[model samples]
Target: MENSIGIHISQSALFNWLIIFFISIFGIRDVLPQETTIKTDSHAVVSVKASLLPKGLLGPIDISPAVIPHDQYPIEPQSPMYPSFPSTYDPILTGRCQLNFSNMASIIDKTASDCSAPLASLVGNVICCPQVNSLVHILQGTYGKNSGSLVLQQAAAEDCFSDIMSILASRGANDTIPGICSIDSAPLTGGSCPVQDVETFEKTVNTSLLLDSCSTVDPLKECCRPICQPAIMEAAVRLSQRESSPLDNAKIPGKSVGVDVLSDCKGIVYSWLSQKLSLDDANAAFRMLSSCKVNKVCPLQFKDPSTVIKDCRDPPSANSSCCNSLDIYISDVQKQMLITNRQAINCAMFFGSLLQKGGVVTNVYDLCNIDLKDFSLQAYRQQGCLLRSLPADVLYDNYTGYSFTCDLSDNIGAPWPSSSSLSSLSLCAPEMSLPALPVSQNSRASGGSRGLGLALTLVLSSLSYTQRAIP
Candidate 1:
């Protein structure tokens, strides 16, 4: 006021100066108000906010420490523990029986009047039906018989037995022998129906069917029936496991092939089918069994290991025709191991492509998804199939930050960690922490205190202030 150079020394300017001086004094007073460094209880604030606020959807979408507590300091009997499976599709402990013709007949008979009726119905429907009709839909989408709309119905039906015979006939198997050709007018058969003029009957049936006369087809179920489901399944398992011959004796230890009855029949069936139907046609039936698409390679016939190295000249290479067989093998193995349908399909599809490289044979386990690993963890614990393994502690904490219903008492006696402990760990771990840190900010703030800690503290303070201000 003493050095005022302007005519602004009036009442308004003096009032403004007084106001500014008082504000400055009050501001400094507020700045240093208490000098009381009260460390904000970040955890308490978070707990309170979490308890009060409504949780969003992404909160509980986790796969670990699947169980959570209902209250702070969970009551002993109130909270329960849960288990987890690494993968939704883990392999079943029980082994499946191989599907055979009789088995197939049984399945068909269970659904229909008899095997013949169902078979005939399906065949007739496939043959007479239009391209995009129900018959074609079921075959294409559900139980496929062959790889086509409907054109291959007749050819596929004939080739089913033909392919088997072709393989057998190629090895000196003919229709003139006793055991080998038991279907040829042989009353000495032990099974349901004795062979009655097997060759003539087969030829007559083929000719009749080919001519589209619909004459009663000869019942060749006897050949498939005598094979036995157990034996067939065993054979299929062995064949699948076999690296060389489909029926190599060396594979069946302590047993010798006295006579190649099945082999001879297989050869004859193969020859007949190969002649009547094209290679594509013969493969159509096989494709149905393996569920492969047409023009797409199908699983190969299982080979025997011992004789393969000695007698076989053309061994399957990585790029050879045998890759499809390997693909099927890998797919089957995955099916045996995985339980989740979608996951199993994914694995089958993935490995189907890799089998051609021969790399899958050595690294099958590695090719599997993390879900499979989860299942393995559960299987090892032998706990009833829920929450196979404890999820990461950090994951559990973050997961419980949202609304959830957990039963911690389930594993009371088990030496498992508490949900709280898991939550703490999850909070500590960067991968499972809540309110993830921004990468850019983290990179820019070098040598600064952890951003998560600062961000969480700031959020809690803002929330606390806002609540106080609201009142």
Candidate 2:
């Protein structure tokens, strides 16, 4: 009987303690200030110029101070802006990926800016085009002064351009712009335009030639110059990988001549072509280009004492066919067009726009094997139409032909073939549910935590009163 009585008293004490604990916690919550819980279930945008929390727990996060300003550049109030290349749009000459060019260019531009810092402060990562000039200067200061063979010089230039292009292409896609095969048709679209007919390239090469020219320049050079000049220098870096030329019988001993860079240039550039050039096409081109080496066919090959083989004299001149062949090899069959598509999407998305608006079409479905239904095609078409209205010179400069531009942008507004509508798309992944937070009541009302604390305190006080009343 005595043990039972003691057990009952102990249970009573424990119960009272529990009640008091709950009330104290609630009371503490009531005394605390209310807090707002921001639930980011939807897309939440934070601007670069936005003010931060007084406690400094939250703020507009700047990832690369070298590129983006913390409190400077106003978050573009409307949308991201894409790079506007002043030129005529050409499909065949620029590789049917006009959209990629515009979009990728924009992304590169933005990311570059993001990585920069105030001049008064130490400069950070130089990412965008404006900073690319500095990057070039830095690189030149490091390597260009050497008396290395021209092949090395060219390779160095090419590498730099490819790096920049790759960076731009990677960062351009977003919620506004579609992903691969979303902005345009897939590579298969290139197959729609026969590859066997190099006539387009032949014409472009002929047009680019300045009568009896020893070489041909990119047709889009006029428009792409603003963009391509940097790209070309970067691409020229492939020259650095060249092998020293074989010694000629009459030339000075222990001296270097020209260099060939690629181990399999001829094979990748010529033998591996298919119906539609895939992304691998760029890889192949780069492989051949980076492996450029000295051609042994010297005097017969064009005997300039400099074995660089970049130029040929009239007597041993390369036939115009060489330009035609090269054009077909570089522009016609290589996967540069596919890359352009990827780039365009990246650029357009950076600015909350579409390629069709800029008068360029990427054939996302045909080129990237993406289904139309997987994305918002109607939205993209609307954006494309807007892009089409931009300055014509940007189009002409970037694309070599007006026909190419029209084919990409104007046709976007045309009624979609029933087969290609978004409804027919089957590649979309299922959307996931987002988390939600409790809705806030009156701003002046106690928050969840504070209310809980107050209730806890009140419960403790009540429990104490009840204990005294019960005993």
Candidate 3:
């Protein structure tokens, strides 16, 4: 309660400060009394010279000290003016980056706006971090063009990464983006991966196979089929073995690499890919690759379920308490962030098991009338949209800014996990109320189900998702 009060006070103070700054820069003549005036020292509120001001939408006018001590004022009142980008404002560049930043104005502007300091913490997961990741991947390809090598040397990585942050900050992006996105210059430097250059990476890994597998992604089933992920992992493992002796290499054919080593090598592989593919293709492939990681689990954080357990332990006897307590808990959950429908299912099952473990035997979701969309940040609560699992990304344009597709064709009931336990529950598990299209669509008998019939069924089963723009 105190925290909420503090936040409200902080927001009110911030709004008041912004209003003052706006008034000082562009004098609010209409709001000011016609006969009223004030006298103060330097950097204080002064008068506006309507006649002397630049004419015809000349942009933000500088409040020169010379304009003060005006004798007569215009009798007619004017509307409040506002500030905008200064005429001479330009991003301070390091002049070290080989990539031409001028060519990337649109994306840079998009990233700057999306990842601005005021907005970063609020939308980091859905907006800011995604754009930051995309920008880094795009920069990798662009910088690789002139350097011939996709990955940068350590010194260059330091300089270029600094320059990237400087450019974004000058354009009003969050300076703490590295921390916000958990990124560093390490990826640009290719991490601790032994293979940095293209020639050695090609010689060590099956370049042709890697390229063929990931050049294009089938969005619908890439998460399930996982053609590119394994290929990337295999390539990363082979690349990680560059420093190993021939004997160890022979013993570890297609063996798994350690966690850190595998991640570093994957970054190296992605750099090598940037050196080969166009920027658009690389960015798309990277988004698809990222989707594979986010597809399996729920991103929303869950709190302790003690309150829910106590209130929801009994069924019809405790209906009012159970539903009331559940609605409160779910409201808190929904404040986490927007998530996809597939992720929502996992979240429901996971949370249900938590409740079941805490002595809540009954399915509270059925009693509380919880929907799948209830598991995510619902802007419209009773009728809000939840995102689709795969084929999701932040789309940007001059007009639309950033947006993502959302499933809005009515809410699906949050499936109550049976007493069968969470381990036995799978998306492909039958006897469940949720959709099950089987694990392998291609392995169907006579290849008949591999056609569009089952695919159409899969599409219709999930209903429709629309592009929802966050304000």
Candidate 4:
């Protein structure tokens, strides 16, 4: 296969790069983040729209829709960051499905971007798989709008599932969504959930409380306040028994039985709500729930940093060697993948503790003045993406392939441990207590997203976008 590569950099950033280039040509030192205010307040923050476009993730380009005009799509002239697509390009679709793909077009576009070819394997566990599962529930609701069925039957499920994969493949989306997520048509068939019908579920559980708690979800406070999750758990527990079964009246597991049974019941509960609520609301609520889970932990796997510790064993009073090593190490970390703000904290704490154990007595973060954004993919550490700790989703436009929001907090330092840190600290605990590090800016903002304005978010799987993609 031949490689078809293109980059779409924002016009403003390209102009800035040119300015830096010219300054260097005149022999004047280029001013950088070293001149910005080094102090950080994670509390006072705003989101910057950042797009981590998967440059080569979709594999060899498929120019299926033959000849078309490109200028029909109206967007600010982006030089070379996102790959441009035809605004009017149409995909070959299956006509047998009950749900009109036209109405669900935006989400279908997002699915393609989230589950793109190369990205599926890298971020399948955290981003890709979870999104696919959410999409399924939403699709179920949309499909049964007129019919009022919560779950699809065996034959209908097979046809609709085929239609979905077909549409995604026709676009540049990855075809391996099922295998990558370890899912099957089983979810569409209601899987192990005993209560497949809406009537049984509504009658068995307290539908009123469930609807009140989850009809509207707050992405920011839901995880901490936890109104919906507790309600869902309560409903699922009750449904797990359901008094009796339609199959054989067999007694299923009780509330305190195996976790697997309860989990199945939770799926049923979601399906029940999907029928009761509108499609958009279901999508939003499901994505927000996913956001809560993904933002909780560090998704990147850290390698042994024997070399970074060795090079930074002592601070040099004369040369820039130690700081040089520190910068190089951080740059390498930033190239791994896009990370959430909360994950950045865990990553920072982990590397700091490692250095301490390795005999690097001094705090390298202080010495170098490395900001929290330094640990994420960035252009020279200042123009970086520290993903917000809220419900973030991959976006798709007629022009830009996929984009997301990132908090552009200025020069937030990575918090060094006062002593040793236990890995079991729960910053998200309801008490909001920080028994590890002393209370400060780090404690308050560590588990929270950037306050206020939202601009969309994407945790990009890989950082090979700027590099040329060849196969």
Regions of candidate 4 where Cα sits further than 4 Å from its true position:
1-83, 86-103, 110-130, 144-149, 153-158, 171-176, 179-183, 243-259, 312-326, 356-361, 380-382, 395-402, 420-431, 434-471
What TM-score does model 4 achieve against the real structure? 0.65
- What is the C-alpha local distance difference test score of candidate 2? 0.25
lDDT of 4 by residue, 1-471 (tens): 123222334566788999989978766543322223333476654443224336576689766543434454557763444455423335555566677877778777677777666555544544666777877877776676676566777667777888887787677677788787777765675544666666777788889999999999987688777888899999888877764444522333233234366776787778777777776787778877877777676665656777778878876432457777777667666665666667777778777888888988777777777766777666433455666666555555655455567764545677775574445556575467644322235535666433324443543422443321111
- Taking all chains together, each candidate's TM-score versus the true structure is 0.16, 0.18, 0.66, 0.65
lDDT of 1 by residue, 145-257 (tens): 23211112233423433332332223222312223122221111101111112242243333333322111111222112222222323322332232333344343334344
As a whole number from 0 to 100, the lDDT of residue 94 in candidate 4 is 55
* lDDT, ranked from best to worst: 4, 3, 1, 2
User: Candidate 2 lDDT, tens digit per residue, 1-471?
Assistant: 999999999999999999999999999977765544554668675443223335555767657534553333446542223222222222222222212234234333433332221110111111122133222222222222232211112334444444443443343311112121122111111111111123322332222222212122232222212332233332223322333233321122232333221212221112112111232332222222221210110001101121111121111223433233222322211111111111222222321122233322332222222221111111221211111111111111122211112112212111222223232422112332211211223312543322211211111011111001101
The C-alpha lDDT values of all candidates are 0.26, 0.25, 0.66, 0.66
Error of 1 at 44 (Å): 94
Two-way TM-score contest, 2 vs 3, winner: 3
The residue-by-residue lDDT of candidate 3 on 351-416, one tens digit each, is 888898888887677666677768865553354456655544444343333344566334356777
| Candidate 4 structure lDDT | 0.66
Model 3 residue pairs with clashes: none
When summed lDDT is taken over every stretch of 10 residues in candidate 1, the lowest stretch is: 458-467
